[model samples]
Target: MGSAKWIACVSLVCLLGVLSRGAAAENDFGDFSLSRSEWSSEYMSLDSGHFLDRKLLQVQPSSQTQLLAVRGDRRDPLDNFRKYRGGYDVTNKHYWASVVYTGIYGFAIGVAWLLLGALITLGACFKLCCCRRPKVAERRSRAYYWIPRILAFLLSLFAIGVIITMFVRNSQLHDRAFKVRDSIAASANDATSTVRNVSNTLSNVDTTVSKYNIEGLNSSTLSSTVRNLNQQADSIDNTVDNNVNTINKLINGIEITLIVLLSIALFLVVMGLLSALMGWRTIYFLIILLGWLIAALTWILFGIFFAANNVTSDTCQAFSEYLATPSNTTLDELLPCVDLATAASASNVVRQGVNNIVAQAERSLTQIEQTSAALGRPVTLPTVCDPIGPAPAFEYNSNCPNGTVTLGGLPGVVAPFVCAAEPVTQACLGAGQFVSRTNDTQIRDLSSAGQSLVTIIPTVTRLTNCSIVYNTFEDIVNNQCPPTKRALRNIWIPLLLLSIALTLLSLDWIFANHRNKKERYASGRDPEAYNNVPK
Candidate 1:
């Protein structure tokens, strides 16, 4: 009995080991089953399912009697029973693991979102309290006069958008992670159960179990298949490591972008508040205008980041698929081609051939990588592709003076080369010109230091009268003209508050007028008093 206990314990230990490996494998694919639907997608969409199936799917069976064949493949009656039991156990474990991870990730994202919401709410309260003391009419004027309230509102909106985006992304990552975990656990359990039951049945009859086993192979085939599968898994592991390393670089870039954007936004908010409180209208408006201008400028940074992300993701996915089989042509062909010359001597032909293929692959990979980095990375502004009428005809370059804009060259022709972003220039040399070229309506009536903004676009007539054009350059390095300078105008909140204080001086003027008029009218009753009325 003691000997029997020892054997059973060893068997159980081995069984657990097999289950663990199986579980991990399933997790890699999330909970997504390799059903007919999945197989079809892998076949048509990926165009590389055969490679994955032969390399990774054909690993050695974990124990005697265990098999890894097509789901419905006909097998000996006893083998079928063992496979079914093993598959079920694996499925169960993976599902449980997935649930746990999903819950944890969800909680973290929820907490972050809640915190951001609370901060916004707190900011709003402060805003209301600050203005509560003034009369209703005065408060109304203060609100419209544009100061802390507008700045706060805009900042809050930006924060909200950011928070929402983060929540969505976090949720997606958590979901995918949990799915992989669950599938791995379940697959392990299933594989283990099948082996255990089969081993037990064979032992009951004192039948010796085979040392090596393959799902659909005889003894000789079993050993070779097992070796190949092991090699394939190892290769895939290496590839995964490479992909992760690249992703880390992208993650670092994203962190920097987020930090810069947040700092700029926070500083703007503080400055706007201070200006409004100080009663300096000119200064306040100037600051507010600056904030809007910065926000608009951020749109370009966002676009570049997005482009980078797309490239990286595609490259990573392709790499992941390649790793599942080292012998596969997809990865093998592309891994070695960095610097060999294609037009070299015959002695160098072998090196050149490999390098040529690798070089081609590297170029494709680089483009994808750059795109991915840009996408996964965060930016200060979200890209807004809305057609804000026609683009500006103004010529913009990095060399353009900071605050003074110039539209050089002839009127009816295309605007000079102006890129929204420096690195990626628009293709057509004279692609699109600014819509306000005709000067039918003066965009800016510039005379001396003062300038008034007028809209040339008839569709946006509302801005024609009130919008004041100030001396400011394009939103970005490129001449992607933003909504007329009103959006760019920095109505520094702090400055706006100062202006309100100055507007109060107008009240003093009204009071002085009243007193003078009263004295003059009273003096009219007596000529002597009328002469005494202060000038």
Candidate 2:
């Protein structure tokens, strides 16, 4: 019974080990199969089904998959705007219409306010200078005399509060502007670096290919392809640089302009308040006119920011849709997709070249082995992995005969044989020369060149596909837009309040001046009764 139990336990352990290994093998195979399927699907649109095994140039599949997953459904850019605007089409037409209407409204309100204040001032001046008044006792109550004064004092305090709020909001706007500018600059710099790296890699590939002297490997086609890609990369780099620089300049200009304008507005408001307190009619009137002008300009700025917000929202929507499905969009004109056909062709050429070089090296090794055996030297060399068959040229074959020696491993394997202390003969000389020609460094360089070409495909794709730009736009929309819009609103709303307060303060100055003149005239008319009159 003890022996039977031991046998059963051994059998169970063996079975478990087999099952575990089989599961691991199954998982690895499944992963490879899935990867192969993805490569095929990605290239199917390019109509290059023959090059589906080129998995290295898969175009940032993980990012694309994540973006698609995040964007579960297509979205329209104008949806929210349409709902708010009562189903109005949110096109350039809508933007222009809003701008025009807002501008006209602001202009009309500022002009009307200025004209009303001017009329009131003229009336007060005319009554004081041109109109005749009866010399009679003032019968108005004390409450009537003090009410306007108290109201003017309260309004002036409110105006000060509004100005302080405006200052706070303006500071917030400044911070928001800098934040946006930095965000844009960071994104642009990343995109420029990516393109520049791709360009340099292509140049390196060209140089590496030119240096290769592998037998039976044709690299002319590959060199031409790399040159073409390099040109495209340079063009893209220039375009991105120009666009980003222009945007940065615009942001800086807007920032400086807003700072100057707001500072002037604040200065004018402060001066107007002092003028009111000191009862300076000329200075008060001047401040009102300047305030009207600033108010009009602020409204115009509000309209502009509104239009920009709409355009940005539209762009975000378009970008989101592009992320979901990258084809067929106007954005392609700005950020073009890499030429998959050209990339695939380059990959195929590299693979074929590597295969040919390996094959020729293997043949040379076979020749060396045969010659050594015939000469009784009998130098045993490891068999090189043959990548040239009906299967994919780039697919690694681990099941190669007699301990697979890769292109990278060829030099190490041949080194001992070449340095072996033996009789120096014609065969030995040949083997030594072969070793020099097929040195490890040379093979490694070739392999590295192929790898450089492969890796750059996805990078170029990411650049041309505008995936980085898309993510930037996403950040702008989700993270930056709301705060910016809020800051803009905060700025303009406070300006509007300040305008109203200034208007009322200007009228109070006019009324207070008239009241003082009336009192002085009454006092001069009856000097003895001036003590009884309200002073």
Candidate 3:
């Protein structure tokens, strides 16, 4: 019994190996054959019965093959030329059949790819959302260890999606080629039938004219009859010529259309073939999706970390102390926040407040000095106008000479003046005015840009992560995923659900096998039934 079990396992392993090797071989050759550009290259199985007769017919010669001998300006070269025509080319028909066969092969590959993609996607979803082992299982693997596997699986899915898309595109081209071939064939048949009918009608007319003794009638009447006959013959000749020209035009159109279609199809196949040569896994699509999910998770974690570390009250206290103390003045030096103008034009409420505080302190000090001066009554102090009334407030300007200052004028005072060692030039004054206006606008513009960037950055980052979702190609390749998606939430969701169901089914099958084994051991005395059971 142990030996038989071992043999069964070995056989299963061998079968799997064979299947894998077979698929690899097919893929390698299929790509090469599809990519080849030889004129004789064909996709149909030549060994098959259906193609044998077609091959024979293609090689055989027909009466219309001689029409090429008398080729002229396609003018009225021969009267009966149209009545016995054949197809223009045999090679074109064969090329089309090859295209059809190639398409069938590609379609088969696509079906396999779709199944593989679903399997891989399901595996990834299971790794993400489900436990490695069942909840009731005794042993469990750590989730972190499985992360790499999940990423690898997803990447494999992505590559697979690309391969499938390529295969589908190739198949579509092949189908177009087949359609063109069929159209050409149908047109040829129509032309042939029309020509045969005309030939038969003409032959009958010749026989009737011969049978009748019209030349033995009255001289005048005979001459009239002959003239009418001559006119009718000319008309018949013209009609036959017109019909033949129309058939030739139809043939030319079909050939041109087929050639164009075949050329495009050939290009697509070649491109797909070259792309597949690189050693790449087909399941890399799932990896891309997994990558996005990882990014989203990373952001969620980062946001949590940032929130947890924030100390609002402490931050406020630190900010206030930092502003007040000169000991810790690095931030002040770095930022260099002067009392920036807040109003429209040159008004700055903040600068005015600072000036008020400074002026009040100075006046008190000055009064104390004057009191001492009065109490001492020493040498008479020269009366001096106070130079400490209000420190001049300057409006911010981009083009102002360094250290140029502006006085905050009262309502009646003649506007404001720029103060410098040298009187301000007209050019300088104009520059300063332009600078002030631009500075004000720039500050506002910078603030707006900053706010916009802050708002949009996180959203843009999230959208970048969401882009992986669009990398999906199940529907695009064969439209298999749409039905699956509509039937469920998405392709992955159904695949995940199905995987769980299959796992359960597999386990049930295993358990049933165990149960049957126990039953057979209990009744091993009946050796025939036990043997049959194993088989």
Q: What is the TM-score of each predicted model, taking all chains together?
A: 0.24, 0.63, 0.17
Q: Where does candidate 3 have its weakest 10-residue lDDT segment?
A: 12-21
What TM-score does structure 3 among the candidates reach? 0.17
Model 1 over residues 225-339: C-alpha lDDT tens digits? Answer: 2333244334434443443334334444444554555456556545554544444445544454444444433433333333222222222333333333322222212221111
* Best candidate, TM-score: 2
Per-residue alpha-carbon lDDT of model 3 for 306-344, expressed as tens digits? 221121111222233432321212221111111111010
Instruction: Indicate whether candidate 1 or candidate 3 has the larger lDDT.
Output: 1
Which pairs, if any, clash in model 2?
A: none
What does the lDDT read for residue 36 in candidate 1?
17
Tell me the TM-score of model 1: 0.24
RMSD values for the candidates in order, in angstroms, are 35.9, 16.1, 43.5
TM-score ranking, best first: 2, 1, 3
Candidate 1 stretches greater than 4 Å from native: 1-230, 248-256, 277-297, 304-535
Quote the positional error of residue 497 for candidate 3 in Å.
Answer: 25
Candidate 3: misplaced stretches above 4 Å? 1-144, 167-171, 203-210, 213-535
